[model samples]
Target: MLRLIAATLCLRCQRVRALPANLRSCATLSSAENRHTVEALYNLSVDIQKIRKLKGWVLHQSPVYVREVADLLKDMGASGAIVARILALHPEAILCSPDQVRAQRELWMSVCRNQTELVGIIEKFPASFFTSSSHHVNQRDNIAYFQSLHLNKRIITKLMASAPQSFSRPVGQNEVMVCTLQQAYLELGGEEANMRIWLQKLLSQNPFVLLKPPEVLRQNLLFLRDKGFTTAELLRLLSKLRGFVTELNPDSMRHTLAYAQDTMGCSEAELRGIVLECPALLYYSETILAERFQGLLGSGIRMAQIIETPTVLELTTQIVNYRIQRLRAHGYDIRTGSLKPLSGTKKDFEMSYGKLQLRRERPLFNPVAPLKADD
Candidate 1:
């Protein structure tokens, strides 16, 4: 009992000594109420280990900076929870001065449309806006750079949200790439106005290409050229599907070709022609290729027509069956199919096939919308 009393006295004396220092340095923490409010701003219960790692930095941050950052975000309609998530990411982000935080927040709000959209972007890629490199006016500059290229705001939003890493690249590197791609495109016989138009469309369509190294583009082109793809053919292929080139390695390419020749029963000549005609073929897996072929062939689309219009290999079974049934109902022959359904754009297909009128004419027929996925 005497030893226990001695240990309790020492613990009390230690707390007494530490209290004076804590009160002297941290006026806010001197009161339990103030301490509770300050912590409520940054402390969240998610990812406990990571949030704990931020504690030391939080201790040294100025109370004014912390208060202002939280107030600024809250005033603009950000909730307490969102503020906590942001601060937990980088406690020093509070040290970024309240004005800097407000400016970044507003800029993101403009790009993402509203606070909820901005929060989604933050959740998707926190480093895009909350990192040290993203502080102050960097977000505005990055945004202005894309706008300078005359890209529409909708396209910019899509690009930023879909692949935030696209904006994570160095400013100069991005500029150099745009210039190089333009010059290379011009060298390939593109006229000046057409080159700008083409680049805009292609960039909007395949913004992910910006994330790749220049070597990747070069390598894709060289590999195709060596495989008997003409420059014209290569460009056409890329326009249809940009991801195909990046997703394939030499081994995968070989396997893809083998499946087309062996499983799909395409001859060597037919395989070469198909790859040249529809580079999307290289992008699809062997499984997808097999399924598409079986689906089309099972719809009574003959082998010769399938070879002639290899793009039919892109459609799913449900779609193939739907179009075939509709064609039969409308007295169109499926045994000798035209390339219009598979090769043409959806608008073209709808216009040429009169899908809308056909559907209205035959109440029992319901053509699935292209964008709608089958269960």
Candidate 2:
């Protein structure tokens, strides 16, 4: 349903703005309901022209209760402008019956502390709040189920907003996935007391993990175990990947490992060390690895340097080239120096460059001179 709405309601502001005012007004004035919806929205200071450009279909669809939606949002402490924006962005909200909106409000209030927080969440993620009436039962059950697990309310709210599909499914499906994750954590030698924290963090980091089948995680773990990863190493990998470990299947992982081994001429031990250092290498396609490798080699970086700082492989070729060029201008040759400078984010590279600049410009007489008061 969301997909259908998304496909139909693409916001082409430029094209919509190009339409003549007469045509726009005629479309909105074609029916009494449309005129009423438009007048109510206008009264709330909604940019009718903008909404018409984005979702003119709402004006055409009858039985739209813009006033009811406005009243609900206003009751939740939303200002007039917010009410207008919400309607404009997600006009489908007005299409839902008053009963559905009230039910959704109550459902959200279960996790949200008060009206202020509820309004804030709606302001940020309107779609999550104004879902179909059909999902009400599943949403209620899933919320209760997650609460029963002792997961944080904030995390549950986030899951609903970001991964609504998780909450829309029956509680049994999420239960199975959660069990699988807990089992995997225990099997990896995670302590009993820390299981809740681990599970909370995993779900918080990647709620869509609930959507994956239990068998995929089992297969991935088994494949890793067969590839000589001990339980301890597996735990570390899981921690490093932040619950995205389930994204890797045996076949893709096998192909990636083969490519990395062949390209780097590294033995099994060396490859394991590399993967442990940067788990992305286990999931990165051979094509992407080849591009990054070529980017580094093309910059005169040696194979040994890459082996030493495997994390640099995470950076794109464009970023690698830009950093290398900057370092060369600063007379810090990455070809001879360590690849550490290029291993992190853009800010990290700038900090490393600043340190290099300070080292290059420091006065040689500082050692012979007296220290200043501040120094």
Candidate 3:
């Protein structure tokens, strides 16, 4: 019966049921089979209508293996609602034959501890599990390659779920990028014992780093070195950026630096200090920096104040305006005062505001405060 269902749901529904003997091996689903597949999907509580609207081809080009796919997910311990959501979001999962899906499942299971973990990953990133069958060989090879490096199985599972493209590439390509990162870590004075954990954190933070060309990383590191970031400082910056250092290129970095220097009228050393204090300065584009600078300057904030607390640039113009308005309403003058009070996350801002409000409301006599201090 399972084989019968698999044959009935084959994608040959899109093809004409006529041809040579070898081609005849593929079955063509009649209207009855298509209706049955749709009905089965509906019975599974799948939003079949939503899927049809989102991917109309599911109705004509593909009458999917609804039962086979749902059963596979169920065996993996996915609840009925999750199974329905996955199918509704990515109806193409039912396009693959049962054999192909089982093969994919086995491949994923090699990295995953069990079917339950795999289902959790699928729930978060449905497309990662439903990648093309053509990449299965590459995926298998890459999993073995990562294992050979002795990376934690948990990290490997994360790479598969969050950055499946890294596994879909040929093993040789990923091997080169991995080697580049390892060499960079060693050259930056990273300890041998810490390398494994560092690599795991890097991959977990930005698995897409594996997809960057090794040369880009080399060039970016060289550019930073020229800009006077020592080996230790480079390592710290890389960690702070969460492995996104590879995402920078020399030209863009130069452009952002030039903008900062010209606008703030700061020397290279001062600019470097600012970047170390607020690494976002290194990654934000000239346009974004300009908008933020203008917002502060327009609000009567001095360049000297920005230099003193560069982190305020991390906030958007609208946030800066809102915060400044709130501070002004409380009779605080940010233009003359330090930007430190405005330079952190929303919770930090709220804490600072609370303190300011208390100060404003406190009695000058402070009778309770003096008694408490004496006590």
Query: For each predicted model, how many residue pairs clash, with residues at least 3 apart or on different chains?
Result: 0, 0, 0
In model 3, which regions exceed 4 Å deviation?
1-33, 325-333, 347-375
TM-score of each: 0.60, 0.84, 0.81
What TM-score quantifies how close candidate 3 is to the native fold?
0.81
TM-score of 1: 0.60
In order of lDDT, best first, we have 2, 3, 1
lDDT of 3 by residue, 1-375 (tens): 998877876746535343333324434434533655665666787776686568756755454688998898898899999999898888888887888888988998888888888998888888888888899999999999999989999999899888889988899999999899889999999998998899999999998999888999899989999999889988888777767888889999999999899999999988888888898788899889999999999999999999999999999999999999998888889999999888799999999998889889878885755454553
lDDT of each: 0.64, 0.86, 0.86
**Candidate 2: which pairs clash?**
none
Ranked candidates, highest TM-score first: 2, 3, 1
Residue pairs that clash (backbone atoms under 3 angstroms), model 1: none
| Predicted model with the maximum TM-score | 2
Once fitted onto the true fold, the runs of candidate 2 whose alpha carbons sit more than 4 angstroms away are: 1-33, 45-56, 365-375
Tens-digit lDDT string for candidate 2 (150-241)? 88898899899889998888999999998988888888899989988888888889888999888988898899899998899999898788
Q: After superposition, how far is residue 71 of candidate 2 from its true place, in Å?
A: 2.7
